[model samples]
Target chain A: MSALLDSVLATAVPLDRALLLAAVLFSIGLAGVTSRRNVLIMLLSVEIMLNAANLALVTFSKVHGDPTGQVFVFFAMTVAAAEVAVGLAIVIAVYRLRRTTDVGEVAALHEIDYGPVRYPQLEGQPVHHHGSSGNGDGDGDAGETGGQPAVASEEAHG
Target chain B: MTEVLFYCFAAVAIASAVIAISRKNAVASALWLVLMFFALAGTYVLLEAWFVAVIQILVYAGAIMVLFLFVIMLVDLKSEELAVMGAPRFRALGLLTSALFLAVAVFVVLNTRETFVAAADTWDRGGALEVESGSAAGIGHYLFHRWVLAFEVTSVLLLSGMLGAVILTKRRLT
Candidate 1:
């Protein structure tokens, strides 16, 4: 047995290869999380990202011939489990309240509105295209009507 | 022999990961993730960490991923259109970042002169890592001896997580 390949065979592969693979996985996870919306899928993407890091850690541990990385992996898994538990609970609550788990709709809540932002009750209330009339007088006219005109227009759509 | 297995499994792992991320259906994505985990376990085997490979299969592929599947089954997510494709800027940014990272990783790997193989030769006979018939013995010794405290802490954390999860889902009395 050739010493280099034989030794590598024993460990399974070169450290460089393992590291590169882990990095690729990590980037895939990163892209998934960045682009995907559905909160559940986002959380899953995060899990994948964490796994990618764990792969790197374990690969390094094997390369160094140490058990420390395994120990760290155990801790990381524990933390990941905890994160999922909390995260899923939040997603469930959000889904229950929102009806539709669409992130685009949720962004509307960030607007400075003067009423209770009851999202659960607002899911199918009709599309509120307040400023989409291509008019620069939105803020000026909105002050006179206290945004009632927007609600009226939406009710007309409904 | 090992190098071939390593490359094969690595390719499988990467391809499956990409499939997992790109699949529009959540369940299909989870299935791809399972394949990716299995391929990763194969890579671990090639690395000679037999026990780690088993744990990778049992814990990650078997247990953790099962939980992910369960959660995916439980949730009812609306099928969102793959709209990020509509944004050219985001796609451009993603490609740029991935390419940059790949370039840096390759540069680092090529620049490193001495590798783990040289160290392994000297460290094999007498070192912190005790080679055994199988990794089970070595891992068992280290886990119980060197990592006893951390193990116990993990147990506590898991317990707390279970309780916390139950509490989060429980109906509150008015």
Candidate 2:
């Protein structure tokens, strides 16, 4: 066993070991993302995946003795930082609208519970809601905010 | 010596990464991830890329982690309260699937030969001359001379990210 250890360390470390580490990190991230129901944790898993890629980039950069790999890593980090900014912003926005960030719950899907019976118009039509031009721009804001527009319009009329 | 250092750092990185992902508390998880990042930076040093190693610690451990902590605090550290009943079984399945993928990935990685071993020879061609390729000065030279356009684009990307975060978090548009 000691002989094997000595032999392994005798040469420059094979790139294989570094690559294997990256694979393990990536799998861990994949598992975390799949199992976690929380949006925040899922984002954390994505960050893990990004870091794993960075590890591989640096490993390869070391192999070629080229600065290009490091440059690629720089670009990747830039993109990752941007992604986190935008993604967290969206998550926060979603959480504001619905108090929870659970993926399984039907917070945003509440409208689907209403079904076709409420609308009843043009279920038989192939286009689905495209023919509802008569509803006009007035209903557009109402549809977006649920009930907020009705109050604003009523205040305007008053 | 480098190889020994490589194994030690790799072990630390993987172990901490496992702990990071498995933790239920976001703060604990973030702390573990910070350790993982440090170990990975150590590995970068083992590769003799001093500039990359420093940047790994500075950008990832310092800047990106602060961003993660900011978002975690903003979210109030809430985990989903989805029912516990079938959750364990689902989580176990996720573990099994990822383990299978890890096995396949490791197998493929080991079987494939390194793409360009010629660079190792290049390192031997001229002793002092070859040293420049992996150094800070070398990277900066190429980054400005060869890849200036991409560098400029990276700045624009960060600028847009700042605008996006501020705009999205704004409470009142009026």
Candidate 3:
């Protein structure tokens, strides 16, 4: 047991370990952004990426005993806050129009006609048909669906 | 003791990050992300970056996460709709690509061991006097003095971002 502990301690240099953790976290965030269809979750993944970058910055700051990296992290945090504000506003706007947060549902510019994008998960329910006219005005056409009333009322509330 | 603590924090951070990304529900994902941020804050403390650690908790775990949760609630996705991740093939491809990227990053870090060691030696030679660099006082000295211009720029950026968000979300201009 002592031998195992010694090995672990000896191998775990704080700087290297922290960098590795940042890298892993970054890759996980990348996976999240790529796999998740929900725009909100994608934004969350982006935050993860920014946080990983901040971790790396702080780790390097410690290594050099310089506060510049920490200052940069402060700026990064500010930028991230701003980004989330704008991004969530955009998400809310999109959600208001589409009534669904799925990226698949908002592919008004995908350049391919898949015959009214289908949500296999929401089986037997009315699929939020979009882009069938191919005019790239999916938002306007979305009003024809059954979910339109709720979105309209929400827009009015806003 | 520090080594043990570092490992514990790293483990928690990684585990929570994995869970944060994998959860089907955005609210669950946001909550797990908060846990991950806390773990990362612990790691920051271990690194002696006390100020950064505090900001990590305040800005990330507290404010940013609350914004995420608010949006999640506002969007209010049904459980069935939230379950619809992308196609299995795309997910597999993404995971594979990120795994490859991780491999490359780890390789680069390992190969640059000598460089990092040299940097550490330099710090030991002259940087020890500034050991308080991670403290709020230390950081403030640089932020307000040397980086004041950048600081002002950041304020402007924040102002613009606020205005842009307001314009984007407003239902009507009148």
Candidate 4:
């Protein structure tokens, strides 16, 4: 009976344990975001990450002599809610257009046909990696400033 | 005693969170996330932040979760159409990268380890109520007095976010 009760209860958790829990939750969320192609999953993963942050903040506030960390958690929650609202709106817009939510297929903004990507030894074709930040159906004008496959800024050591 | 509750909550929250995010169905994922939020709220209570614990339940588990479910319903996505999870080769790379990140994060947490040895004579220990800095009322004072400007800004942000969502998706519901 004593052993059973002992199993049920535990000693006081150290500060590190809280931090450790936060880290675990954060990492799990991070991995979920990376692995999940669904935009909704990514957004949910973001929520998990935000919750981890809140956990850490509250823990720190208790350890120290302050309520600032808890206050910060409220701010975080507000931001998170706002972000989800906006993100879900965007996701809906995208889904309506393409009828799919796959991030890979939603590559309308990808750098199309620069050159043989990844293998830079066949021929050191000048890589025109001029990065474009524009997002619209009409991104061709921006690509006009695009360089060749490989921009030889420096002399290629033949 | 507190340690036991903390560990149990933490373990269950993490496990459920994993289940939540890994589920293929978005609705299932949201449900799992609700479990996580509840467990997290329990941890907050254990930490003696009763107000935060209440808000955690009310805001995160209650309001936020309902919003997520609503959005999920609106999206009404099919599993087949939801296929943007990258390729097998790239998926492996992402997994490896996230694993590395997880390892580094754990290492940092361990390195910065600090135990939460609660000192005597605070309101938490059935002590005097003279020093109530970490209480909910204290947090409210800090927010309205010290961080009032930021607080107002957050309200504005929330309003704008609501307006933006309405503007973005206000079409014929087919």
Candidate 5:
């Protein structure tokens, strides 16, 4: 076993191999973020991307024989932790308000007015459809009224 | 032997990452992500970044994943809802875009491999020899000395993040 280990250690792994792995993982994570609809899964994908970056950083650190890259990895991990905490909190809050984690249905802030603006939180109820009358006052009032009920309902649900 | 182990870990990491992203179930995805993290940690070990490898397992595989599992359980998504995806065309477009990105990145790495390796070799030869560069002691010295200010700032970032999370998730402002 010792002899085998020594022989293995004799030939160091190339840096690009690890870098290629990082690239592959990062692309996979990107695909996840784009393809998956679940907000939680999207967040997981972001974590995977961060992990891939960490792998690349560690690999370079090994190659250059510097600890600075490792220190950067430390900071990256701290930021990742903080990001996860805030992100999950937001997820919980969104789940509570919308009763669903589907990213498609949680578009309350989408202002494009794409055909009768379906608010998932206000489902199973009459949505006051104030037609965009091409007047600023009417549109503003409609927007205010549209937002107020969602908040009121959220409070009631909570 | 090390190269073989590295390849094994890399293959595992890539496979698990692909599985983790493609899985419909969030819990299964999170579990697979943990496996990927473990594989990544193994690769880090092979690179002799022992401290980083340990932290990779502890923080990523352990803490962050538990937090993910908690959210997954708390969300309690139904099966019908889990079927949600964007239009098939958009899905295909997204996958195609990422595949293109992967191809470009791999191409760049392959082309620059010799230059990068030669530069790194020169730096290793010319720089002051630090035998414990990947060890915890060496990392700690850098972290607490040269990177101390950033370390303090990171603590501040974490504190703010915790406070923000608390405020965001609280039942009522009052």
Candidate 6:
């Protein structure tokens, strides 16, 4: 018990421990993002990734006797806040219209449809929504920037 | 002594993380994630990065997760879908990439032999234990002196985030 208590006290020994732990957390978050269907849960997994990165930055900063990494972690925290704000807003909008946040349910924005939608199309390739009536109004095209798949493509059609 | 404690927290942190990913219930998964953060923070403290550890708990486990919970509660995502997850190809890719990363990490750890070198050079602890880095004063001095511009920039970023969040959350002008 005392040994456990000793570990509980934070110190450099724990910092190295934290680095290893963060690596594991980072991998688990990666797995969660890959496997999960719920879009919101997937976003949470992204948060886990950011935190894991923070763990690494802070650990190394201390190890090297430098504070620059912590400053970077500060920036990461800020970016994370912005991402959550935008992402959750988008998720709420999609949920309001489609009544679900499941990736499979939002099929109206599939890869096959990518011509008429006003929103940016998914990067790299235009996905044409399968079976979408070719309205030719750009409604068939969906694009996502920054690797976050765009939301409410179904609502755009409905 | 310290090595043993390090391994213990390391194990607990890794286990909680695996549980967080594998748990079926989303809420349960989030809870496990919170535990993982706490354990991670504990690890930070052990490293003598007290400020980072405190900030980790305060910002991540505290503020950020609160936002996540709020969003989870607010969003109704229980409806069934045509597909629950992506193609198995993605999963295979993830596993392959992560396995490669783990192999690299193991190689790096095993090859590096430099654990302790310069205590007498910059520190007088002489292999004795010390909690806070003697450089804390220097950190504060730099933050207030040379890094003031960056500090102000962070304030601007926070302000923008608040406004952006409000604009994003507000109903669109139909």
Which candidate leads the pack in DockQ? 5
lDDT of 3 by residue, A1-158 (tens): 75654454332245777888899999999998888888888888888889899999987886766789999999999999999999999898777767878998888954355345332223234455433343244355445454454454445444
The digit string of per-residue lDDT tens for model 5 on A1-158 reads 75664476555667889899999999999898888888998999899899889988887776666779899999999999999999999999877766778788787774443344322334334456333333234224535345555454444444
Write one digit per residue (lDDT tens) for candidate 1, span A1-158.
Answer: 45774566653356677777887887787777666665556676787778788878877776677877766776787788777877666656555555544465455655554344343323334344444344344343443233455555444444
TM-score-better candidate, 1 vs 5: 5
Tens-digit lDDT track of model 3 for B54-169: 99999999998998899899988998898888899998998898899899989987887676677656654666426577789998999999999999999999999999899777
Residues A14-132 of candidate 4: C-alpha lDDT, one tens digit per residue: 66778778888988888788888888888999999999999999887767757888889889989988888888888877666666667766778744554333321222333444333
What TM-score number comes out for model 3?
A: 0.80
**Candidate 3 chain B: minimum summed lDDT over ten consecutive residues — where?**
B122-131
Winner of 4 and 6 under TM-score: 4
DockQ of all predictions against the true structure, Cα-based: 0.18, 0.24, 0.29, 0.24, 0.33, 0.19
Worst 10 residues of 4 chain A by lDDT: A149-158
Candidate with the larger TM-score of 5 and 6: 5
lDDT of 1 by residue, B31-62 (tens): 88888878887776665667767877787777
Off by over 4 Å in 5: A1-8, A110-158, B119-129
lDDT rank order: 5, 3, 4, 2, 1, 6
Better of 1 and 6 by DockQ: 6
* Model 3 lDDT on a 0 to 1 scale: 0.81
**Model 5 lDDT tens row, B1-174:** 777898999999999999888777888989999999999888887776778889999999899999999989998988667767767987898899889999998999999899657755665465432557777998899999999999999989999999999988876443
Prediction-by-prediction clash tally: 4, 0, 0, 12, 1, 26
Residue B125 miss distance in model 6 (angstroms): 5.2
User: What are the runs in model 4 whose C-alpha is more than 4 Å off?
Assistant: A1-12, A110-158, B82-84, B114-134, B172-174
Tens-digit lDDT string for candidate 6 (B5-103): 667767777788777766556677678878877877766666555666677789878887788878777774453441356568876787666666666
Stretches of candidate 1 off by over 4 Å are A1-12, A107-158, B81-88, B120-129
Model 4 lDDT per residue over B20-61, tens place: 877878898999999999999888766656678888889888
Error of 3 at A110 (Å): 9.9
